[model samples]
Target: MRGLNDKVTLITGAAGGIGRSLVRRFLEEGARVVALDLDAAGLADLETQCAGHAGLLRTMPLDITDHAAVQKTVQAVHAEFGRVDVLVNNAGWDVAKPFVETTPELWDKLIAINLKGPLSLQHAVVPLMLAGEGGKIVNIASDAGRVGSSGESVYAACKGGIIAFSKTLAREAARGNVRVNVVCPGPTDTALLRSFTGDGEFGQKIYDGLKRAIPLKRLGQPEDIPGAVAFLASDDADFITGQVISVSGGLTMHG
Candidate 1:
């Protein structure tokens, strides 16, 4: 959490479960945050929730899949803040279904949101970081990408691509002092997870099964994520790059 005070931080998917938590954490650490999300109403709600830190937060509606828009937004942020200190690529979307049952349309949406969107943001922001003071990039992937999830084949593929991309980008950008890393969450209790498990006995069965399978015997909470994310984004992780940390409560582990 060190060296985050007054930092210019941008977070996508800022209206969602984990996204909101990330926003609050950064504000608490005294960072200036530009919260971006497609859900304008949700962003408003988040703003109200953090009204005490009004000057520290600004919410913007954004569709990360739009490349040109992403570039413009990054430019706007740099114009206003002078520099981007941290960029968190956290926006993602998915619907759980078997691979064969899923359609190309769903695949397109998955790739656009989970993969291309983050890539677009990085493409825009990295140059700014390289030109100015260096920055940190913390990408939110998934345990499904690291291991596998039964109903998320395409989503997992996109996340896996993110993992690979972050490592390569880290290596490429290290000399410039622009650090890149990944945080993969597992079975988190988010709206996305609830959508993944629709209402029914089947949903309950999947939920219970996951709880049982996880060594911690519970699903992950949004709050459980920011500590690791903020750490990586902060100067404390100055030496750590090209690494993937699983914040899955023992659901996934790597040596």
Candidate 2:
């Protein structure tokens, strides 16, 4: 793996499970990271956790769904770091309910967070990447998007849209030396998973059922994801673009 020494990386949802893992991993790899998330307290906690690594990490609290806020945050990142070489669109939200129960309000929220957020981030960052001559973008999608999932109709749809958007953006941006790709994590052990499955015994039962179906016999850790993100964001994946790599512990396969 190529070292990211001095590289500037921006990761949205940086206060969340997978996002926080990615931020730490990238910093460990010697990159300067701009961490963006909606959770102010979480972001502050992460800042404290990474305090010893001065100049290596900067936390920005922002709502990705807000276009103006995203633009401002992107600008601030560039101002702080001078350039952004990697953009990880890792922020997302979902609602778990039967398709019949999914109202338009819920549908809009899913799309706004999962699809539009990434779109907004890309809009705000790509030009900066182009201006800097090159960059990488990795969208953290889900296997639920690839194969569909119960109680995640709108969520799946939004994720699927991310996959499609990444491909198109990859093709369009290649000439500018920008690479775009998607990482589809399957049933990861994240706060979002807990929220989706509900509380206590009921959640454990649902998790256990999913675990039994996965060939790896377990859920993935947030740590399991950053390696793929790091690889995709590094020179090692320079020739790779418009691809979907499933980090799902063999939970799903695509030909």
TM-scores of the candidates are 0.99, 0.97
Residue-wise C-alpha lDDT for candidate 2, range 6-120, written one tens digit per residue: 7899999999999889999999999999899999999999998888776799887899889999998888888877888999999998878999987998888889999999999
Model 2 weakest lDDT span, ten residues long: 1-10
**What are the Cα lDDT values of the candidates?**
0.96, 0.91
Q: lDDT value for candidate 1? A: 0.96
**How well does candidate 2 score on lDDT at residue 58?**
84
Per-residue lDDT over 139-209 for candidate 1, one digit per residue giving the tens place of the 0 to 100 score: 99999899989989999999999999999999999999999999999899999999988899999998899
TM-score of 1: 0.99
Best by TM-score: 1
Model 2 score (lDDT): 0.91
